[model samples]
Target: MTFQKISILFACLFALNTFSQFQVDADVRARFEYRHGFGNLFPDNTDPAAFVTQRTRLNVNYKLEKLTVLMSFQDVSTWGDTKQLAIGDNNNSFSMFQGWVQYAFAPTWAVKLGRQVISYDNQRIFGGLDWAMQGRFHDAALLKYKNKNFIADFGFAFSQESQRNENTDFLLQGAFTYKSMQYAYLKKTYNKGLVSFLFLNTGFQDFTDANNTIVDGVNYRQTTGTFFKFPINTINFEGNAYYQSGKATATKDLSAYNLALEAIYKPNNTVFGLGFEVLSGTDQNGSSKNKSFFPLYGTNHKFNGFMDYFYVGNHANNVGLNDLYAKAVFKTGEKSTLLTKVHYFAANNTLINNADTYLGTELDLVYSKNLLKDVSMNIGYSHMFASNSMSLIKSGRSNNNTNNWAWVQLIVKPTLFSNSK
Candidate 1:
């Protein structure tokens, strides 16, 4: 074994000797995808991509009364991509997905530090992007308080590329992604219902010119929102509203908001749901400041459409969106289910160059089955009927062909070792 592996093994052994309890678990997921048009666009004359990707994770847990610790190692990649590495240069796909320690000194307060996942409400603002094989994690610290009916969490994070660079400019991966962030989340539970409030503040970095004569500029943005869900008899309803202010990452001015409402009826194995989301958009006029709202760090795939043509990395600094959709779910058996969804999308307003408002329609279908106690499988398909607007927005073509995609996935989770009492 390498030095790193040996060091980790020794550390694990030491922790086991000192900790009051320890446990271990593992997860493996493989997905085979046939992508004719998965994302917004594909190059011309390119055949559909068919490949298998896998993610494997091993987790260790330690607990001692008011203190708890967790560490997870993850590797995500396609098959046969990392075989027979060259000398001294190894495959670098493995990473620490989560490593955190939580300690509670008071009965109602606790603090957690290190890398972790932050998800709230319906994961509209901050989410763990589980759809992606690598998933998502944040290196930060969090303080949480909870009781029977109330819970609250406060988190802060800052990112830097290196320690000895002596650089003043913040290194941002993208313009829209945050370089620094903080948030406050509060939740209250009522009989048969619950409500959550969130406030998130983010900042983006802008470096000066090459000569370093100018000060690096920074843009700050704030998002405040509330989410509520309640059940009335046999029907369940939820609503969300969020507003954004302050300068955008790339623009000098920003003012935006988004609102949504949804209802679900599930009296039996069959279920039905309907929802609508409205996001403010910028006007086509040059004088109008940008009014488009963005759900930063959200699970966009869960909304809009699975094809990710709307908010999954595109559509920023552009026209906003409106998504109206319906879904039906039928449980075939105790271990099998089928789900179908339909969506109609439109631009909140015309584009800057005066394009049409109707974007397109999409259909999605999925089937899931539990093969064994620790294994599950899923198959999904999606088709997008692009309109003149969608084609113009995604591709330059105003008259493009239909887009289709398919995928099959299998998940396996197991506990390798557990000797805690």
Candidate 2:
């Protein structure tokens, strides 16, 4: 059906339904960044880069007795990318970030379909990467069940380039997105802690030929993990363990693992935490099987370091990482706070010639303040101190250069309309 016709039908349904709720909201954010070495080590004789990026979103939500709907329109662009008087945007930045519908068939069972955000326990494997200008989403369907202390979800998806009468080859151009995916998640809650389990299966097209031709049907991989959080007095302990197996490519086999543990202590207005994490890596000398563990479709920026030296679209399938970090959050004022974090990084596998395992150390600081009821501001800075081994992994880049990044961001979220029965 046409979009206009569907809108009219929804309008009619809204009018006929007496017991319903509707709401509209907006999220506008702009950030300015100064990057000297933001994703990678800085090269010599190169100037720093600075730019501003913005993301604007409009969300409409509706709810009835057994149905819920959400439509989120988003636009993301860098400042000065478009002319002031341009008839249209230079690049197509407008898109439907999320358009989903849910229907509850039973008291504790429901199904959701369409483009939506799928995030789970600590966002280890699935997350809504809201830190990026254009967040991540999935076009899939989910079967959901929730009760007093138990929850479960089953998800499935398939991707194709376009409508074609030929073979079913997913040649969608862009990054290496999955060809198909399926997952199941279960969680049980208790008085003091909760534990969750996730089992994911993802498939990729076998593009083995030099010309990017599809050879085999598909190669599949599996990820199984568990996450748990428990509290003891004023301290909380959380951890996760995950393993990956199956085919990484048409030829290479995948075998990897990730383990993490964290402890947090909250006292009064201050929070302190210490964490240790390790992702299995492949040997530098080379191996027939791939052992690097990649955390697919997760908020990786929240880990490692704010400088994004690992994962955030880079450092995949290479020497994996070992990150030991500590963080502190302090309430500076009634409406302001400060956060500081330090990370010590190393290679999980033997480096070339078995070089030093210590990669580098990073320091991150962020200050946040609430300006108004629905407005907030944040400023952050990060510095990276690299070692010789870090230079080896980063393509022999000079680690002697000073590496730092800074950013300032402003966010405004406002409720435009709301009607509840």
Query: In the order shown, what is each candidate's alpha-carbon RMSD?
Result: 2.4, 2.7
TM-score for each candidate, following the candidate numbering: 0.93, 0.95
Candidate No. with top TM-score: 2
Best by lDDT: 2
| Candidate 1 lDDT tens digits, 1-421 | 2468648955885667466787788899999988877777555766788999999888888899999989888888888775565432155767889999999979999999999988888988888888888877888989999988999999998887667657656654653666788999999999888999999999887656655345467788899999999987889999899999998644467889999999999976899999999988776545457788988887777888888887788787667889999999999899999999999998886765787788889899999999998999999999988777776567575436548899999999987777665
C-alpha lDDT (0 to 100) for residue 339 of candidate 2: 100
Model 2 error, position 348 (Å): 0.1
Superposing every Cα of model 1 onto the true structure, what RMSD results? 2.4
Quote the positional error of residue 60 for candidate 2 in Å: 0.4
- List the global CA lDDT of all models: 0.83, 0.91
For model 2, the superposed segments whose C-alpha errors exceed 4 Å read: 1-19, 173-176
